[model samples]
Target: MENRPDKTNKNNRTMKEKIRFYIILTLILVTGILIIQTILKPIPQGITGVQTLETGKQQSTQNSITGLGFLQPQDIHQIDTCIGDLSSTGAINPGDTVELKQDIYVGSTDCLNIDIANITLDCKHHKIIGNSSSSANGIVSNKTNDATVKGIIRNCHFYNFTNKTSIYTGKPIVLKEGAKYFLIHNNTFNVTRGITLNKTIDVTIANNTFANYSTLLTLYTDAEIYINGNLTNQTNETTIYNNTFEGIGISTNKPYAIYAIYANDLTIQGNTILTSNQITLDGVHDFYLKENALSRVEIKSQSSNTTAGRIERNTYIDTSTAMHFTSFSPNELSNISIYKHDMVNFSLSTMGSGVEQIKIYNNTFAGPMSIDLGSANNCTIWNNTFYPDEQTQITTGPNSKVRNNRIQNGIFKTITVTGDNTTVENNIFTKITGRGIVVKANNATVRNNTFNNITGIAIIIGDDTWQPPSHPVNVNGTTVYNNTIYLWVNLTTNTTMHSLLTGLPAIPGASTGIMIMPNTNNTNISENNINEQNIYAQTPPNMLKAETRGIFGKGINATYTLENLWIHDNTINTIREGITVENCQTTHIWNNNITKAGKTGIKTENCRGTRVNNNILEGGTYSPNIILWYKTGIEIFKSRAEIIQNNKIDKYHTGVYIYNATNTTSINSTINQTQIGIFSFLSMNNKILNSTITTRHIGINLLKTNHTQVNNSNIRNETGYLNTTGIQLSLSFY
Candidate 1:
């Protein structure tokens, strides 16, 4: 009877605890039921929901459908058998996707014809194999004249269509007229021809690999065509970017990786092309070609205008002709700019007329090149560096400017300006083996140029040939001023063999500073510093065939004469001849300082109305190694109406030698430190007045001269030899 009262209380407490445990169990069971229901129930499309499945894996239920349960028979058409004819199944409708189950073999006519819009054909990595006798395509759209058919064909393998009898034979895909908004991607084409898009619009072909095809893709009359990351061939309002082109075509005669004809608004960029051919553009305008690695590029305008383009920062490697611009007619081709390019073994050739406003700057050329601006106007070439192994030529047009360029180790004429109103200034020419700058135009100003270690003529003015009808167009009104010409004849020994083997003209050991060619008129050569250095002869005597002079003005053989030439305030040092004027008329040479001349300081032959005034002509000590055949300070031969006045002539074999001259006068001139002071041979009517002549042998020696008078002159013989005479007249005719 002791625990009987506590038994009731214990029972009541246990009952309450049992109620709480039952409630907890019921809640747990309801939560498990709700989770199972959520996992099994379907989720709405594109709505995010989390659920744990029976496999204990959490997954997002947003637009997630597993298995093939959701595919309707009308939406997905399975291709189990080979297609022989397309008319049996009618056209593929919109929102339909055809899946390839097995490899299909097609007949010769039509495999799958599509004339409807918004259809997709996926091959599921199965090949569409064609028979050798078949000329059918894997997919083709019929011609919709005024209507557009949009479709997509992807993940298809086209193989072994070997028939090439016709142009359309062996083509895998053909999009006919009025096809728009079609996407062809991730396909492999191994047939004879890949795809053809004719009159298509807004087509994108990407991520396709084409191998061993005649042409990977051909586009005709298509606009807004975007090609990216594909290996294909030949586009307007077109973009060709990030594509790799291997070869040109099946036939080796085809030389274009991509050819666009009558295209407009094209953008070609980021292409890596490996072919011996070029990318060609014909009748194209408003183009941008940038950031490409290409072999060559060609632009041609025929019956249309190609205007306003840019070619920037593209690399050309191991190509022969990098860029070529041509026009069939004069059609105002204008506004082209090319800058910041790295070129190797390349050139630029622009031909035909009506080309204007071109700019080329900041390019580095490693190998030899030729930049020809044929008949182009208003062009600018600046800040280019050239390291050429062979001959390099840069020819400019009218109103062109070539400034601030550095030419290193060029073998031939570096720059040539044949157009009028051209300016060549501030150019640095170093180690040039041939002529540096050649100007054959009128009204040219070549100033502030530095030529160092040149082996040939530093600057040449006037034409070399006068092939009749192109008569020697005089280099009239030309000024060559403030030029620094330093010719190092010692550096030209190795170049002789190269010149001889290539049949190039030999560069003279005694190179010319400036050469004014025959019939040059009104030329002014002033303030030039020419240093020849009197370099020794390293080649054979027979091979040394160049006439050396510091400044030479030449004329045709008494027919065409150089007129109105002025050479003043120039300094010449260690040269063969300081200045040589031949067959010139009305020439004035004044205030020049010449030193260490190996031969005549100032020589004029067959000149008329010549004046040599206030010049210092000094010859160095005679060396037996040098060929001193004509070591005279002032030599005048066969000249008429010549005046030699107020000149200081010294350190020569003969101070003044006048031969076969008429009406010659030497007044107020000082001649000293010579063997013979004033020597005349076969001269007539020459007057020597108010002159000081000091020599060791003879003062005034006249042989076979007529009517020569010597008045008011002082004569002194320093050596005082046994037969020294002040005024000896021998064989005087009158």
Candidate 2:
């Protein structure tokens, strides 16, 4: 063109080379339309463009294809198999996090069959091993109505496995029904049967460590199980706190560590159970068993309606029976409360008839206890501290109240009241061998008690050879008041003072402070204070038997009749017969104050309308030479309409003694230093009026007499010896 710039600049250099060839053809057609728009853009749903090629082969690249692609070759061979490699059975979705590095030997039947929900099976502490061929379960979820399977199973280690198919089948972890919000924390179970919740809902099994399981935990009809901290076991609003159950009950025959059935609102607190036998509750409702360290506890209610049950502060060891309340129908077990326990080899049994309001308070017992309120009504056993070995019975409950108890070393009959309006008040019975308080029922009340070293009968009302005196089980209006009975007798035992001195058919020693036998009607032995010390009269291969007595009323073969009986204001000491009435009727031995009478100080036999009034007999006879074997200070036999008034007898062999008595009457009595003072035998229409007799031998003695009357008598002989007498008649009539 320069030649044409000469030529017109060579046509403008061919138009600047045709404008550089149309700008190189417009940058090659805009780089071929940006490589065909990056080859048609779109690839993302669980990712794919296939490129993982480090040698495990898979390459389809375009440049930005991130992972989990190639149609999931078994989820990329289980993410290259190693970290909790569960490759056989699947389906763990919705934000899954399955982490368990080793130990996993599930032999089928359910190693892990938790269907599909918001999963997280982090058994990071490994072990989910189980293989007993088929009836197995390591971690299961049946999913009944579908609570949408929510989950979290942490630090797991479940072992063994044996579910012989019956007895609710050996479980290792089963959440049935509508499985919801499950969180089984820090697990470590040595399974034979541990954890089973049927009908589940929002469960939380915390800090678990259940060993050698038989039934470490089981709850049928489950609702809200929130078991806290280490070891576990309960239902419908359950809360088991601080658990530690170590069982050897061999995995279920009847071996229960905790087996709650048909539960309602159960709460078991601070557990430390080492089981071999029982801890079962059937048809449980509103239960709260606190501070436990148990061996036995059974509460069975057949049809529900079990109300507010509470077993408090427990610590029972080596138990045969610590707690048992069984009901099959009726009201189905009502409100129960057992408080502050510390029992050892204890016993408590309540059966059927829908047990009512029960309250066993402040307990601390060691060894024997047999409390059976079979037909329980409003029961209350107060402030207990019993150390009974044998007869520790508190049976028959109605409006029961065994008050303020502290019974120690009891062998038999510590508290036996057949229960009508039962109230054994303020008790403190020590070292009893038998009978401290035995009221056969009927408005019962033995008040303010304190009996020490009792061998038998400190208070025994009615038992005329065991109740059936012509169909009269009457211990009517029974009340033995203000008691304080002490029978030392040098701690008693010539075989128990010869069995209280030869007891059988009548008495050698039935050891009585208060013993009202027969039908015992309107009975009331008032203000008692009996103290018997070293009462001696024992020639026991035969003889020496004067019916050892101290306030005793007998009538066994006479077809029972001890009516309107009231022995009043008693203070008897060193006795061997001080107030003894036989077939009593309208009997009232009044204002008693007798001391050291080893034989008789108010004795009546075959009594009629008897009354020995204003008594004050002192230091009489201990069988002084046994003549007619008379050791008397007012003794009447075959009595009828008898009344010995204003008595004051001192140092006697015989004073006011009547035999075969008929219309007997000894008025205004005062006899002192007597061998015999006003003594009538074979008496018919007797009367010793205004008596003031003093004698060492005989002041007024009548033998084999009839129609006797010694009027306005004041006879004294002060024993000048050699047949001394102021008036002595033999085989005569006056």
TM per prediction: 0.73, 0.41
lDDT of candidate 2 over 253-343, digit per residue (tens): 4556566676666677776667655667776778899988877788877645467889998887656777788888744787888888877
lDDT of 1 by residue, 541-605 (tens): 42134345688887765767889999999998877678988999999999999886767889889
lDDT, model 2: 0.67
- When summed lDDT is taken over every stretch of 10 residues in candidate 1, the lowest stretch is 221-230
Q: Tell me, what's the RMSD of every candidate?
A: 9.0, 20.0
Clash list (residue pairs), candidate 2: 1-10, 4-7, 4-8, 5-9, 214-251, 500-509, 501-508, 501-509
Error of 1 at 489 (Å): 1.3
Candidate 2 scores a C-alpha RMSD against the true structure in Å of 20.0
- Model-by-model lDDT, in order? 0.72, 0.67
- Best candidate, lDDT: 1
